[model samples]
Target: MKLSLKVNGKKIEKEVDDNTLLVSFIRENLNLTGTHVGCDTSQCGSCVVHVNGKSVKSCAMFAVDANGSEVTTIEGLEKDGKLHPVQESFKKHHGLQCGYCTPGMVMSSIDLLKSHKNPTEEEIRKGLEGNICRCTGYQNIVASVKGAIGKV
Candidate 1:
């Protein structure tokens, strides 16, 4: 199958198998390994990426499904060597531990902030309910999203 995807603001055209998952395509085809595959079942947010400005589990979607759609991975957040405010906030707030879930968390947080810039604590928690971080206790992860709004 042929797929044309807009990933991280770059146009990508590739030949892929019908069974190829979006996460596999991003990590292998595009070499954007920032999006992790913690669980192929789509339960973990580790495979989260923004598709057309909305958060979706890359593992749950097919590469062909994203044809011509804009995709944003962790690598897309940085520009001109400057990290996104959410990325910086995650660092400052200690939002990660083992770091397996950081990419998805940041991606999801970016989408969340887009919808609710001034999200309350409960809203942040609710927004992140899909993404699970086994390493960090999630206190700092919540703080990171909340802290990123003003800075971004």
Candidate 2:
């Protein structure tokens, strides 16, 4: 199957297997490895990416399904020489420890802030329920989200 989509603001057209997962397309074809594959299963949010402005688990969707959609991976969050506010907040608040889940966390956080302009601590926690960070105990992660609420 042929897939065409806007990835990180760049139009990309490529041939892919019908069964190829979006995660595989992003990592193998696009060479954007920031979107990690921690677990092939959907239980892990490590493969989360924005598809047309909403976050979806890349591993759960076929690459062909993403054809014509606008996709944003972690690499897309950075602009020029500056990092996204969420990325900066993660660094300022020490949101990650092992860093395996940071990319997805940052992606999810951006989507969360988009929906909830001023989310409370509880709302932030509920919003990120889909993403899991084994390291950092989530304390700093939550703080990072809260700290970035105004900036994002």
Candidate 3:
């Protein structure tokens, strides 16, 4: 079926199979590989992307589900060659080690911070329960989110 998508602030019209996961469409079709597919299952947040400003696991959703919706990937966070505050905080706080989960973590952190405003350490931990990262042990990751709250 033909679907129109607003991705990274641009409009794209494409044809996709009904079973095509959003992850595949973004990485294979749109070539936005930053949204990794760590787990095809919904457990991993590696495929997280913003659907109209709310983070959603792309792997858990189909490309057609995003039809006519606004989607933002990790590549969209950087504008004019400048990193977003979350990205910068991740770098500054060493939030990533293997770096596989950084995109999803960053995306989720942005949304969490947006909703929480001033989140406690525990709140940050619980807020990111959906996203799992094997590296960095989440200490620096939480710090990155805390640091990016007002800065972003």
User: Which residue pairs clash in candidate 2?
Assistant: none
What CA RMSD would candidate 2 show?
0.7
Per-residue alpha-carbon lDDT of candidate 1 for residues 63-107, written as tens digits (9 for 90 to 100) = 999998999999999999999999999999989999999999999
Which is the leading candidate under lDDT? 2
User: How do all the candidates rank in terms of TM-score, highest first?
Assistant: 2, 3, 1
Q: What TM-score would every model get versus the actual structure?
A: 0.96, 0.98, 0.98
TM-score of model 1 vs. true structure: 0.96
The models' CA-based lDDT, in order, is 0.92, 0.94, 0.93
Locate the minimum summed-lDDT window of 10 residues in model 2: 128-137
Give the C-alpha miss distance for residue 100 in model 1, angstroms: 0.6
Cα distance off (Å), candidate 2, residue 139: 0.2
TM-score of 3: 0.98
How do the residues 1-152 of candidate 3 rate in per-residue lDDT, one tens digit apiece? 99998999999999899999999999999999999998888897988999998999999898999988999999999989999999999999999999999999999999998899899999999999999999889999999998898775
> Which residue pairs collide in model 1, if any?
none
* lDDT (Cα) of model 1: 0.92
Candidate 3 global CA lDDT score: 0.93
